[model samples]
Target chain A: MKNIPGDLKFLSSHEWARVESDGTITIGISDHAQDLLGDIVFVELPEVGQTLDAETDAAIVESVKAASDVYSPLSGEVMEVNSLLEDQPEIINTSPYEDGWFYKLTPSDLSELDNLLSPEDYSDVCED
Target chain B: MNKTPLYDAHIKLGAKMVNFSNWEMPISYSSLIEEHNAVRNAVGVFDVSHMSIFDFDGGDQVAFFEKIFANDVKKISKGNKAIYGALLNEKGGILDDLIIYNANDKFRLVSNCSTRNQNRQWFEKHAVEFGVKVIERSDMGILAIQGPEAMSKILAIKEIHAEANNLQSFGCMFDDDRLYAKTGYTGEDGLELIVPNMAINDLWDQALEVGCVPIGLGARDTLRLEAGLNLYGNDMTINNHPYESNLGWTIDMSDESRQFIGKDALLSIDQSKSQKIVGVILRDRGILRSGYEITHEQGKGEVLSGSFSPTLQSSIGLARVDQGYQENGKVFIRNKALNIEFVSPRFIRKVKMQP
Candidate 1:
């Protein structure tokens, strides 16, 4: 597989983030997290305008096998969630980086991205 | 841990491994949910060769099994079969649940993998008195092709459906040395093909190429649970009697003439005070798992087998509940309690072949 655009920031919690042109940021679970969760059947997204920290529970993803908590990628206010997940939860398991993007947020501070794992660093963690 | 013949194929397909009955077997390939759904909506093949297949040889084999098992073993003909039968002690305590294939005078038995050794010993102890032969066919391999498209897949490869219309549910076909039982743990239509050890690869290749995704024990548990089928160790055990485990129908207490192994003692069994098994569905958001405590308004219950039902879209379980506890009562899943309905084991989708 080609590189998953290393420019996107990563959280230790296995979430990936990319800043949007509107100054807001798009967020979703990393490919690794989705792979671990298996088939995602239900997703509970964060409400718009809900303030969340960089590393605290902000959403829920329940699969046919088990349920998991989706963490916020950056400390910011939630702007929008991918409502399509209500019917197409498996989309995350199939395409976590693209159609599976969960929500968007405006970063409290772009410097916090330093705490996130780079694509290389994230791959190493998953390898182990 | 021992690996089944399909271990390499499962591993190569990136199956998740788990320890089951001392064997390291694949629990699922890409996703447990997807593989699970495939079995429910379409069809899936399972590598169940780790389970023990015992062939009873020589004379009086039919008489021996009929005496030991609670099911009417005498009813099965050469090509027909019997359902899960109980080996009960004198007091009705279940020894083990197994299926007997009446391969003419010789019978081929498929038993629970975890109870393989114990079942073998029990069969041996009883065979001497009945004058029968018992040999463990450990060299045999079993592949269960189950679900709606099960018959189609097998017919596509082999002309095995000739016995479908005749081999009733829980029936078997003893073609040469192989045993094809119309039985499955999943509440789906399928055949459990027991082939010689050497034919495992060839049979597996044919089953897989015909669009049967290889399923694992994990899916097996989920599928059976959705169907409300009981697991041997979970739903019933030595400490519990067949009557108390809701297997009362299997006990042949009415056959006064047939002096079977456990008949005399079963007559004295006190069914009025037994804690019978019942099915439960969790009404809460929490996923119910095994070993969780259960308590109703009347008394306490224990979850025998529990999981998130992929088909039902809810958490379900089989529990040993107090007989007095109204079948419909509140179920305690972990610490949270939820009101669930009391129902029979007929929760699985109905298959055409099922009578």
Candidate 2:
């Protein structure tokens, strides 16, 4: 299993986001989330440019077993989506963090990142 | 939690374990969708040692089975076989679905894992008068190699005549020591092999050497759903009769001369209630899960089994809807609407079936 980068933030629901150098954020479900979901087959993301609040359903991750919503780590507007997931959704199972990146967003307020969990805090939250 | 003999093997492969039928089995290895699509596109093997197998020996075996079974197993020739026969209760409702293999010295019976003990109790209670010995072959291991290349992969390891008649659909035979049947719950071409428990690992190794991915229950459900096969407890139960479950053909009542258990209860009971089993292809952006309610403008029903069909690229499920609601066609998955299509129980596709 890949370790979450220290710089990224996590949600208790298992979504992770990295504040990119450009201030746009890279977002996806965490490795723990993908493992729990089994194999993802489809994905539904908020439209690009659609702003969302923290803790709101930003996207939907569908697996053969169940469908779970990916809550926004920080309030933002979806800027870009990784469309390759449309056909090969299983990439999320193999590499939930890197190649499996779901969407990119520009935070409405970068300060909202404080509400997210750091890698250490995220690991602690999942330990139970 | 219970564990099958393959438990250690699953753990060795880094499989994720989950509870199923009280037994902890691998829910996935690398990916459920990949494993599922592998079975659909090529070949995959599953350690189904969890299923129960029994051997019934005696001259009275056929007679006893005939009385308890709804299928006309007596009509099956020595080399032929019977599949999807209902072991019925007195009320004609399904006790369980079983397969009777016509063996040389005895008839081999395979029943559902969860219902095995209950079915055994029923069989024993009823078999005493018939003088048939119902021997539970619990020591044996059951493995299923399912997909397009399944049979050829197995045949290459050993020799199979593969005669058109012998390998015919639903036909089964014992090949030397192992019993290979062109039968499976998945709609794919495959064989369910029953061998001594000690030799399971070796067989699994051979199957793996031939490039069959080891699949788990997570993929198993998806593959079965893609094929549109009904799961036992989810699709039907003691409360739900066979007719309303869309399994009418499984009951062989054609020969009035044939007397099977539950015939009287079935014949006497009223099917006038508002229920019919149907299929739903989930159209919305969510996975339709089992036990989720299916709604229609006419009425509502419950999803018996639901999964994302790897082949169809959509969610598929079986449900029992009210007769009035079922007739109008469209079914609802959550708030999203899906078209309900009328269909027969899925058939075993040639490439995915083994005889």
> For candidate 2, what is the TM-score?
0.85
**TM-score, every prediction:** 0.79, 0.85
Q: Write the per-residue lDDT of candidate 1 for residues B1-355, one digit (tens) a residue.
A: 8888878877887888888889998877867766788888888999998988888766687678777888766566444655567888776678788777765555678888898888889889989977777899988889999988888778787635466545657767677787887788888888888988788887888888899988977788888887777788888888777877777876654545777777777777778877877778776555555676777667777778776677887777788777777656766543556677666655684553222
TM-score per model for chain B alone?
0.93, 0.90
Where does candidate 1 stray beyond 4 Å? A1-30, A42-62, A66-92, A95-122, B12-14, B77-79, B89-91, B159-166, B257-269, B324-328, B332-334, B349-355
Tens digits of per-residue lDDT, candidate 2, B216-281, equal 988888777666666778788877677777666677777888788888877875677738777776
lDDT, residue B101, candidate 2: 79
* Among all candidates shown, the one with the greatest TM-score: 2
Clashes of each: 1, 9
Which portions of model 2 miss their true places by more than 4 Å? A20-27, A46-58, A74-91, A98-115, A124-128, B77-80, B159-166, B175-177, B269-274, B283-285, B295-300, B323-329, B338-348, B351-355
- Best by the DockQ measure: 2
